[model samples]
Target: MTRILFLFIDGVGLGPDSPENPLSTLDLPSFRALAGRQPWTSRSETIDRPDHVFRPIDATLGLEGLPQSGTGQATLLTGENAARIHGRHFGPYPPTTVRPTVQDKSVFAQLAPLIGTDRLAFANAYPERFFQHVEARGRWTVTTLAARSAGVRLRREADVRDGIAIPADLTGRTWQRLFDADAEPISEAEAARRLVALLDDHTFVLHEYYLTDKAGHSQDPARAASVLESLDRLFAGVLEAAGPDDVLLITSDHGNIEDLGTKSHTRHPVPLVAWGAGADAFSSCRSLLDVTPTIVELLTR
Candidate 1:
């Protein structure tokens, strides 16, 4: 069977929120539907389903202070404790010291050979401007670095222009303005439909969602709520359009939006929800480092 889709949401966590906490204002129906009814004692949970197992994972790499995106994401995609190696948590970019590890050890790099060319793909399409920025700085985010190193083709403007990839605003909202005019909001449902269309074309498709982290940094309840709602709508659409062979895995690195008490990351654990084949294997994952290995195992099996 095809490995299906993998989604990464940045800087999300699990924690308590008071009235003053902006996170309490957001309506996360899909998240709440999965997590609210259950009691989360640790950073992870395994909800048993007939055909699949749903698991929530911890994103923090067992460190003190808030987990930063740089280290957290590196660990999530590479299965290495980037924060511990750097001596402390880092920022939005992977430290130069970890470049070799990220280049050689990430999921994309390790899994590409097994999946074959065009089978493993990164679905996020970058505009010409973003490519120019990366070219000038010679810098890459953990996701971009991992995918590029693994030999996965980075989605480009041509992909968007030719209807090969979908933008983050698969629902056709405000975010679409960032892209060129040829882009259209296909609605969340249609976006999922298109994603399923690509599943047959590729074995492993990875997508990144950073809006939750952005909403948290802004510390606006209205915006955060809207983000959650849009995400929930997206999830709902994906679920509806998902095929029997399609597996959906959602995870994050560190905590930020789950508790809005501060503008920094939280000590709380991030959630890892899975559906489809091999979900049971994820129930045993304990930290961010375990993610890449788990995905590799699932795909290879």
Candidate 2:
């Protein structure tokens, strides 16, 4: 079976060759191996490789202002120009205007007919507090809203306890320290195994890693370095465990942490990396709006 492990590393972009950029600061072996070199900075960026595909899609979708998580993520997941629809870049959370688009066009929604609802997995687990917040505030991230709209079960605390789901962080550090949840911190290898395990039951698996975006907003060099290193370690483990049939696809909505010069998102192009039998199927995508369509075509074909 051709299963996909969609690793959505938030707030990353093809950054420039600057000291503040993690690409210039950290040693990322997994990324290096995939690209056959280090991640390209704007001073030295490339596109269209056999194993890796780096495309600079317009996050803004021709709307003005810096790209944001709400619109950018909605566009990435649903193939809709969310920012343009809203007439402005809108947030950490998606705006109400584009909520319908996300619900309708997310990959989860589009692939439901072909893959079946039972076989698509939103592999990230939420803490009790998160559930409580959503219940009270009626708020949801673009990814969560997309999955829920498609009738997919969002992984919960029990999923984490059963070693079947990953926390927002690859390791369960925050879960162990911040919550009363019995989950303990695991090694990167364990995390990778849990992610790969989803392939047994799922045709499409989505795992969100928001620390990259968080690190970008934090503007702390040390934190940025730490997050990048940890992410690369997890990527290495997943790469080692993934089977030949498992297509590993990594991408982001917008660039932020890649260049810590500011505390906001950058207009730089996002990274779309896919490796497996149908890796080249994604090469034609020119905008963020093309991602879900490309994946839907490949998975259904």
Candidate 3:
């Protein structure tokens, strides 16, 4: 069987203003369609389908203060309580001591050998400038470090230029350009469709969407709604195209986008939604650290 397709949405959570929450706004016909007539909420809920059921997994690690992306992601992908280990929540960037842990224990590093290179893929293609910047500065995030350590090819411009990979937006332009051109409006459904199309060849594909955090920082309800609408459209498309055997796992590192009262991460639990073969494996998870181990268990079993 093909490995799971992991979809990581940065800084998302379940919250009120039901209509305003991006998860709620998403007209995910595919998800709802698969989930049948069951109730869906930004908070944790389970949906049963003919083939399989998708359940929401939590992302909070149970520490005080706001969750930081670096530690939160480290915990999510490594199954380690990174914030607690470091004494407090770290940053958008990982601390020096945490580097080894991220490199050695992250999902990519732990699972790559079991799954093989061709079977594993990270879908976010990088621009040429990003490569150049990283080369000069030598700074890296937990995700990048994990992928690099695992020998997973960090997607590059060629992948995008050749159409092998699509931008986070379908138009094949930089996200900045998409924002500039109100003309480039592709709904969340469309975005998900494109992602599904892109996943045809890989056993494991990971895609990251970071717009929620940006919307939270801006604290504009209109902008937040717009972001949510876009994601809803994207997921709708993915659900429509998803294969019966394919698994879609939607998760996050922290809780920044759910609450707009402050431009900071929340201690509230982040939602983890899973569909397909190994969806049940997530039932064993309770914190961020359990995610990577759960995925590994599912795929390796």
Highest-scoring model, lDDT: 2
Q: Write the per-residue lDDT of candidate 1 for residues 1-301, one digit (tens) a residue.
A: 7366887888777666555344444555555555534432243345766445555566656667778888888888888889888888887999998878899999888887787767887877776777799979988998888888877888875676576676755553543576544555566666666666678788778888888898888777777777777777777777777777778878888777766657777777777777775666677777788878988887888
After TM-score superposition, the amount by which residue 246's alpha carbon in candidate 3 deviates from its true location, in angstroms, is: 0.7
10-52: candidate 2 lDDT, tens digit per residue: 9988877788888766777777766557564554444465555
Q: Which ten residues in a row have the lowest lDDT in candidate 3?
A: 178-187
Q: Which stretches of candidate 1 lie over 4 Å from their true place?
A: 20-27, 36-46, 169-176
Best-fitting candidate, measured by TM-score? 2
Predicted structure 3, TM vs. truth? 0.85
| TM-score for each candidate, following the candidate numbering | 0.90, 0.96, 0.85
The whole-model lDDT of each prediction reads 0.73, 0.84, 0.69
Q: For all the candidates, what are their Cα RMSDs to the real structure?
A: 2.6, 1.5, 3.5
Q: Write the per-residue lDDT of candidate 3 for residues 1-301, one digit (tens) a residue.
A: 7457778888876565454454455554543543453323454455544335555555556666778888888888888788877888888877776778888888888787887767777777666666788779878877787788788888765665554554554444444463332233344555566567656776677887777788887777777766666666666767678886688888888776667777777666666667766576676666677788888887888
By TM-score, rank the candidates, best first: 2, 1, 3
Give the winner by TM-score: 2 or 3. Answer: 2
Off by over 4 Å in 2: 43-52
